[model samples]
Target: MKEIRVFNNVPVLEDWMIDKQVEKQIRFLKAVHPQLTDIHWNEGRVELRPLKRDPDMKDYLRSYGAWHFNEKDVAELKKFLQQINGKGVDLYYSAFAFDYSMVVYKKDGTKYEKGKVNGENALFTSVLAADFDGITVEEFRREKQRLLDLDIETIDIFTGHGWQSIILLNHRVTDKEILKKFTELMTAKGFKVDSAIVDAARVLRMPYSFNCKALDKKTKYYDPVSPKIFATTDHSWTERRYHVAEVFERLNSLPDVIKQSDALTDIDVKAISTAPLTNTEKKAVKEKAKREIEEVKQIKVETLKAVYSMLDFERLPEAVQKMLAGSQEGLRNKVMMFLIPFLRNTLGLSIQTIKQIMMLWGERCSSKLDTDFVQTEVDRIYGLGFKGKHGHYTEELRKAYGYLEFDKYTKRNKIIIPNGFFEDMSTMSDGAVRIFLAMKLGESLDGVKNFSKADIQKYAQVSERTMERNIKDLLSKGHVCKRRGNRRKGEGHVYYTNPYFNSVAGFTMLENATVKLMLSDLTDGEIKLYCFLSKIVGDSRAECWTSQKYLANKIGKKGHDSISKMTGSLHEKGFITKKTIEKDGVKHSVYNLNY
Candidate 1:
């Protein structure tokens, strides 16, 4: 039977310089023995292997045929099998190993078992059967116990991800109705079991595969990672992808894999389990890895500097700044490789400006970067002399940067606000603009997006003048879009208290003249009053209407006089068409929202 971890690639990272420095090679002994290898690409249906089972004679397949045509996903099925058999495991994405999943065989492949494990081996509809949802806890307990029964005393699950690892509880308990039964059964053993749920794209080195045998009932090493795996933001997505086939391929060389142990009291087994790679050896490997880290750093710095300086930055987004700032040394070098050439190609940025931005990044991005890749990068950026695929390198650089941004923004922070802009947005006092953000923040009592004047003031938390200037500035720049109105013939107002507010498209301000009139003049109280009207009058979404009670309770201190003042001001400004209507034997004024 096999257990597979297919999230991270087994052997992805490669450094030409490091490879040269380490001088390590996969010494193939010329097909030492006849064997079968499997490949798995643990992705969606479009990624699964084989439309059906291969005939048993599939063994007749060979070298020339393999070279001529890739096996029709037969490799994938094999990978699935290898992983289930606990052949090998990888903790990170391996570029070289694309197909990886696991396959396993149970000796007694039957519907029921002697021990009540809530046993059920429901289905294997998938050509490889990687999705183990239908299998019950009873089934897993039987499989697991079967291994234990065969002198497999310890349960060291080569965990990859999902419900498979959640088995410390049970497979089906992931709460998805389909897989819950399995979750309950796997975790019920009350036995010491161990697994490692890979964190996204992280993976251990190839040499570490030998470490799997170290898993024990005491202090099992499940997280097979080095500090370097988390050293940069670049490997965010593929860090945890290790395919079954790749691991099996990597570990196939060794047999009875465990290292010889000396029964001693003073020595720890893990430290010397495998022949210690001599101190000089470890140093050489670390140094090579460290150099690769430096090279990546250099490129990253150049890219960020070139791109940021060329843009009329107003400034860098906040989230990006933090990512760039997280590391203290080698900042520019790190950013340059990851970002520079792509920036130049995409935006036509100047190298001189790149240097200047690199300087800025020195304070945040780590250190100054060497300009070695500049010319080559520039040539690539401009598609100089190459006509076949002009933007291949540029596109790759873009994809890399996008992956970096996903980690910086979605994984770690809310957004990418420019530095110092927070102070500016906070101090904004224009009643309308401030009210607009306040409404947007859902009237945050603790923050700026709140609409009420007091809450706005609390949110601004800066000098009154500063807040007022930004609010007015936003008004003048036409940041606020829709203007609430007092009355209109066709638009009879249903509810009345204050106007509502809406943000218009930032670039489309020149087209909408009505909003300009609404922001022309206003006191603090008047601004809040009008903002309230904007909420009710403008075409706000239906969900927004739910918060009116919260707003009223907060802003009720301001008398209805504020409403009257706003209505009069809106009418005078030609913002609405108002008319008198009779309702339930009473006269009422109906207002409408102007564009």
Candidate 2:
């Protein structure tokens, strides 16, 4: 007898059963992306490379499916699911978001007719993932527990036949080497991690999407009843995203073994370092070494300058100059104490100069000390052998001694123009030149900031059309470069000016007033002359001496007459004061910049 179940006065039959696969897929997508309600979620761009079963190839799939696709916003991604939900195809999404409107090209440098994605266009990777295949559900759970025991957070998934685990990073890792090393470390840890999914553009099965591999007869897990199975989230470790560096350090710290089981020949397990360093780690180490070397060099330079006979007392700090002028009887000894270090450490004065200055100050004191006492005091202080800014008086101590330290008037706002930069700007449009200067002014202590197009327009004071046209020109000329912005903000592209120009050991500083004159008042030819003079002038002197011919060649002009005329114009405009100076019977033009 056939039995029928009745519920709520309605008979439910076996033939009337309904599959809730669509509803399950909707829930799965929501679970993965709970930030769907957040407006910024859509700004993170992604790519969906839909692949259908290849008729000619038994197990392979080709990206020839006809469908409506979009990757601009997170909301758009939901729409994409509807287009391919029922279609007998496999769906894979980019591992990381990308800059908008990124055109992907083929391996041979030809443009793709439709769409292709890879690491070349990735903005950044938030999660480091590993795919372990041919493992049962039980084994997947065991591996999950193993990672938990080690205090590693992960999001584990079951993709029909195998397991995939993801470790979220606190911040994005833009470097590909770091992501690759992560996957390699997983493999080296004796897990059967898939080596091929290391690329930033690598794709994984979309959550809640049908795993079409079950339908392929060539696959080991092909089933008769259910050809397509859902990829489900087995467990989620949502406590926190681990710091990117700490996660890498932790994984590399684990016991590693040479992987002879991987069929991939490209990865040489023996060549890999036992402890791999991310690009960030390598950069930090390099910067630390560079800073230490620079500090030593600076100390040496300051020490060498003490031998010069000319002492510009006005250039010394006001407090130091006053102390050197001598003090009353009550403050003489205290003044001497501070002056010793001020001369030796701050000014890097030679021992002989320090002694001479000390003796001179003692003689000028109201109640003078004995010459022998002054000499002995100087020797005693010098014997302490302080090095590298030791015994330097702090600002608080300076105040207590009735002296103002580190006066604000000594600081200058400087705009650094890399030497030989004029050559790159010669061919740029006037608007591009203005934009470049604005970018220089916009630089912070960290060098450059990620700026949107709107931010740039505000900084450059240009119209939208002007910005669009000249910025494109700047990019084409390689004077500026574009980088991905913070995906959380959905901001426009960030640009870097003069990316290829290498700032050498020498550079020219344009005063704030000089920059205004170059941008607004001075002609382009006059600006060129001014920039060249600014470069050759000694740091201590406002005037520079050069032949007209030398200036002509540097300014990219063929004739000395052009340089002479430009200099005359600059002088007329009160930007410089010109004079003729004779050295070794060679009359050279000397121009003093009026800043």
Off by over 4 Å in 2: 1-43, 53-79, 113-116, 217-231, 237-239, 259-595
- Cα lDDT listed for each candidate: 0.29, 0.56
Residue-wise C-alpha lDDT for candidate 2, range 306-389, written one tens digit per residue = 421223343455555555554543245456666776665654444555666677777666545446446666776776766644
Q: For model 1, how does the per-residue alpha-carbon lDDT over 162-191 read when each residue is reduced to its tens digit?
A: 112211100001111212222222223222
Report the Cα lDDT for residue 89, model 2: 57
Find the number of clashing residue pairs for candidate 1.
101
Q: Whose lDDT is greatest here?
A: 2
